[model samples]
Target: MAIAKFAGGWAFNSKAMVADAWHSIADLASDILTLATVSVSLKPPSERFPLGFGKIESLGSLGVSSMLLIGGCYMGWESAITLYAHFDPESAHHILEHIGHGHSHSHSHSAADLGIPSLHAAWLAGGTILIKEWLYHATMKVARERKSSVLASNAVHHRVDSLTGIVTLAAILGANALESAAWLDPVGGLLISIMVINAGFGNTVASLYELVDQSIDKEVKSSIRKQAQKALANIRDGHEAEVRDVSGVKSGQNYLVDLELAVPGSWTIDGVKDLEDTVRTQLAAKVRGVRRVRVRFLSRDAPDDKKYAEFIPGSPGALPEEEGSSKQNDELVDGHSDKHKH
Candidate 1:
């Protein structure tokens, strides 16, 4: 699509088609990255990567959006330069000479005299729109079925490409129909650039939030809380289990839930462990995309702060440090320190 549109744009001197070609090129790159990331992210967890390779999808989205932003800026710059050159007498005369026409403002040049090529470009753009619209629907179906955000983003990219094709088609048709409306071609290019830039920026920000472990939707958290409470209420033990906190963050297509449960002090350690497993199982069954659950048990008489404290043992203002947290924290802090030093 990019090659065809680019060749047509060059042949017909249609800036809108040129801009659309650039967008198509970016979409090609985005598609490649999307496929690569999705494939890599599907790998099973290993000893080294206990959480699996989920964040790669977010990283790929960030790369794709950045490419889009750069492409849009370049297209906008080219269009602006072309529009500015149109007003310069020397530049306009040079353009006329390049098109094999004399610089006469007579407006009497017929299609045979001016060799109008915009019509053919318009037809090519129309073909592109049909193809891209089909691609969008096909990609969108898989994205929904898999609940994949990266695939959804790619589908949106296809839709945007189709819209750009539509704009290019319109610009070519309008310019061909009106003698004095030649400026519309570049104007259309500029508008498409703006839309592309806006989409890129929005996608970039969303991906960044995901990469940084942004919290999941509030409504989802609420639903999980309600479902978990109901599940806990079904336990026949005399000891009551209360949900202390429920939080979750998205990991690619799934969610990682952290739940704190408060139980009666009289519950035995074995009983507490069983309760945690039951809660985990219940939540996993109730939630749509829960990939993993981390359940923390707190005695009813424990301090409120301790209920939500970091599981790290020996940490100030936190619960007793777990056996391996100090080692993990040391490695984590050292890694960050080295990165900053570099």
Candidate 2:
């Protein structure tokens, strides 16, 4: 699509079509970003990095969105230059004179002379429009199925490309039909440029927000809290305690929940384990994209300044109890050696 549009655009000397071509090229970059991010983010957690590689997807999106913004700005600038040339004969003559063309007169051509678009370019524009729209719908469907924000954003980018193609096609046919109104071609290009820039800016902002770990919806967090409280209450019968806190953060396409639980100090280790497990299970079942849940148990009788006992699945126990036991064993060995020496 990019090659066809670019070649046909130059052949027809249509600024709008060329802008649409550049938009197609930007879409190609977005596709590459989507592929790269999906591949990297699928890796499991490793020894060095325990959270997995989920943030790579957000970073990739940031880079891709930046590219889109730059491309959009460049296209807008080019279209502006073209519009200036179309409106001011003196500017056109200056450009031609610099190019050392045979005829460098200011009044050599008028706006009416540049208005009409060729038949071949118009046909190419129509084909591009159809292709882009089809791609937009297909991509959107897959994005929805996977519940991927990056993919959904790319799908919207494709729709913008298709819209640009539509604008180009209309301007080409309209200008060609209205012989005396040759300025419509550049005007259409300007309009498409603005649309492209706006889309790019919006995408960039969203990607940045994700990269900075922006909070999710209040209602979604509230729902998670409610489900967690209900699940905990069911599991901890007869215990006079309540949930301390329930917080969730977005990690790429999924969520990580930090659930603070308060339970009776008399409960055994096994009982606390069961509580954590039950809360995690309930959250995973109810929440749409909860990837990991870290449950922290606080003793009901312990001081408020005391730390929570964190229970995260998959991490080996490096708890304070194990450290205290190691210290006690060392002291016992030292005392036995001292008694033998005495």
Candidate 3:
């Protein structure tokens, strides 16, 4: 009720009122849909879908944007037709007179016919477009931060809405001012249609890309690398740690990245387990968007003779003099040292 009152108070012209109402309804619907979709996506079974609920949100955004684009174009086309017909000057005059009469009630066609190209409507549409663009930016930021493909796609749809709105508003202004070149209105409408079609195509392309399991952005990869490195640093013998592979699966559209961490040989089972735990814990703490971390520890063993040479000075893969002697003694000090006593 309060919202309606505010909208009514702001709507001075019929065209303005119509445009405002359209935007208000669209915003309300989109907000409700977005919330519902997000809630569903967060549910337990959301991951059951191949593309997850992200695509659903994306589709919803695309639908709303397409509607706005089409409606704007239609309005622009009609205005062009009226302008080309050199719409009855008396109608325009009558509209002005009616407005002058302070009849703040309903506007009749007689008044509408006389209605000059609605600059107020154009401004309102343009402002709405800007708002959509702002929403897109905000949503996209959250998506990127969360690594959510669905939100990103929805943001793209919002971008298209904003672009179409801009084009429509520009056409409206041109048609009103250049009444002589009234064809601009229809041209503007046609351009808006083209933009809508292009946006649809873009959405399809994005969905396909996600479906193909395209590699994530470089920044995301860098973040993963950094986290892996941090995890490696927490291990006692992590000097030879290397990342084998980092792949993510989208179950129901949610991301779950699996990381393979290769470490040096000579780490015992307990040591490996500890390293894995450290890696997982450190990654969870340091990585901003990583929901889970699965660590696969790999050990690379040198040949037995090669291992012995690591401690023998002047031997083919031996350590330096003092260190080599110390390592050899350390290896022999263990209870199992007799097994290699020969």
Candidate 4:
């Protein structure tokens, strides 16, 4: 589709069609990137990376973001130049010649390069709209069936493409039909470029946040805490298990959950282990997007336990040594030290 649109746009000298073609090219590149990134990102954790390879998805998204930003900026600049030339053909040639340093050959040869958009270009835009719309619905259907956020996001991307294609089709048809409205094609190109730029910028920020290990939303944390609380309720009542904290960062659609559980000091190590397993299993079963669960148990009565005393065993706050016993021990140590003195 990208190739066909690009060739048709260039042959018919339609700026809007060519800009939309570049958008299609970005989609093609993203599809190729998704193929590799998804495969790697889906791999189970290994000893080398206990958290798995989910960050690969962010890398792929970043790559696509960069491509869109670069391509869209270039298209916007070119379209702006074309739009300017449509208003003042002579003035544009002067500006291009000046930018080209008065060289005989210039990047653009006046407004004539854009030419009159042909009906063929309008046909190409209409076809692109149809194809992209079809792709959007089909991908969305599959995404729903698989419950895959990745596929759903891709479906949304296709929807944007189709909508942009609608604009491209309208602009091309308007330019083809109205002799005085030739600037509409370039205007369409500029609008499409803005959309691409906005998409790229938004995706770039999201990927950056993911890379920085931003925590999941509060709603998810609340859900996790609620689940943990429910799991503990099912355990023995005297254990007094309570959720202390629920926190973690997201990687793609899946996330790792860090669960802090507070239990009575009387609970045995084996009991804590069982609780951990129970919470892990229950969350994995009941939660829709939890990838891993790390459970930490802290004794609720630890502050009152001898093991958690504020003072060390020999500290001043602890039991004091007998004063005479300490002095006699010091004299005995002095005598022994004199005998071994060097």
For model 1, the local distance difference test gives: 0.80
Each model's total of backbone clashes: 5, 1, 4, 0
> How do all models score by TM-score?
0.76, 0.75, 0.54, 0.82
Which numbered prediction scores highest in lDDT against the true structure? Answer: 4
RMSD of each: 10.3, 7.7, 16.6, 8.3
What TM-score does model 2 achieve against the real structure? 0.75
Which digits, one per residue and each the tens of the lDDT, describe model 2 over residues 1-342?
888888887778787887888778878877887788777776777999787777887787778767767877877766665567766867766775676653644333445335566768889988877887898899889989987666787777778788888899888887778866567787887887787778678778877887777777787788888888778678547246567776766766667778777778887787778777887888888887677889777788876533333445454756455788999999999999999999
- Candidate 1: tens digits of C-alpha lDDT, residues 1-342: 999999998788788898999899889988898788877877777899888787887788789889889999989976765555555545644655576656463232223323334688988999999999999999899989987666777888899999999999988888789886777787888988998899789979988998999999898899888878877877777238888888878776668888888888788888877677777788878777677888877778877664435675565877666869889999999999999999
Candidate 2 error regions (>4 Å): 92-115, 142-151, 233-244, 299-342
Taken over the whole model, the C-alpha lDDT of each candidate is: 0.80, 0.76, 0.56, 0.83
| lDDT score of residue 128 within candidate 2 | 77
- Candidate 2 lDDT (Cα, whole model)? 0.76
lDDT of 3 by residue, 105-189 (tens): 2133333432444566576666767787898999999999987765786686577557656765776677678755444544554
For model 2, what is the alpha-carbon lDDT of residue 178? 84
lDDT, model 1, position 61:
78
For candidate 4, the clash count comes to 0
